[model samples]
Target: MSEPILSARAVRKTYQSGDRRIEVLSGVDLAVERSETVSIRGESGSGKSTLLNLLAGLDKPDAGEVIWGGGLGLDVRSTFLGMVFQSFYLIPELNALQNVLVARRIVGGIGSAERARAKDLLARVGLAERSHHLPSQLSGGERQRVAVARALMNQPQLVLADEPTGNLDERTGDSVIELLLGLCADTGTALVLVTHNAAHAAKTSRQLFLHNGVLQSAPKPIQP
Candidate 1:
């Protein structure tokens, strides 16, 4: 089989608060296969976000390392990975289409083809009509859809989403999750979703729980 798209090897992380060292992660090991979807569920303050940041290379672990397949490295991160956050981090000034295009700012090659792709992604996320609206003009769900389009802007091999539906109502949140999964499936992109909602987590191909600063697989497959 091909090498895993991403791997976390014996990773550890800690945070210091007034001389108190908090162990956020402890010797965690994980491997994500290409095109596979994995969800991590945990209680509040369980360091799920910390683990995602480490895997994304946005933060370094206190020990061990995160390895990327296909010779991927931080310098070319935008070309290989995408990230989504609970807070729709769209530039308030840029419209939906422009916000989606923002992901390409670093890895420039923008032209007609790229613009078309951005439009296509927005459409995929069910935001084609809202492409011209700014974040302020869109509702919570629409804004999140724009963010989702932005995340897929680069066509990365992997996407790490941290509580993408945290701000929406249950019904809207469910739809966003479905849209995300559908888009990822169509693109053959691997996904690592960090969330607290058990129902949402169950949608992924695999489920895991974070506890005691370690990653643990679910007792049985949670996919349905």
Candidate 2:
């Protein structure tokens, strides 16, 4: 098989809380191939978010390395990495289209073509009708959808999402998950989704469980 789009080798993370040291991750290793979806499931405070941050290079791991194929190790920033958090980090003042356009401009450079691509992404996320709506005017699910579109605007090789469905209702969450999976498949983008919902994780190609700062593959394959 081709080299993994993203790889983490013996990754470890720790934080200093007051006078105490807290270990968030312990020698975790992971690999994501192109166009594959990998779900990381864990209870709260099990380091799921920390792992995502490390993978995306938002935070440096205390130990181990994150290697991005076709690029050097994680450094200033990774152009091939995109991330979405539980909180919809959309610019409240910007409309849905503008939010996605900004991301496109950041990675792909500003151009009429990039703006058009941004519009296409919003449409793909089923937010064409709400493109002009601000985050405040959109529902929670709508806002998350806008975030998803923004994350995809760069056509990243790897997408990291943390609790993507944490804020939506069951039905809305399911729809959002479906949209995420479908878009990633269509675009051939690898995804690493961090979620607590077993049902949500079950949608991915592979599922991993995080416990006590360690990660292990799920016993059973995740059925669609």
Would you give me the overall lDDT of model 1? 0.91
Q: Among these predicted structures, which one has the highest lDDT?
A: 1
Q: Taking the tens digit of each residue's C-alpha lDDT, what string does model 2 give over 1-224?
A: 88888888999999999999999899999988999999999889999999998888888899998888745665424358777879989998899999888776555568888878888988898888889999999999998889888888888888899999999999999998999889999999999999888888999999999988888987674567
lDDT digits (tens) for residues 1-224 of candidate 1: 88999999999999998989999999989999999999998888999999999999999999999998755779878878989899989899899988988899778967998899999998888888888998999999998888888888898999999999999999999999999999999999999999888888899999999998899996664467
lDDT scores in order: 0.91, 0.86
Give the candidate number with the greatest TM-score. 1
In model 1, what lDDT does residue 28 have?
Answer: 89
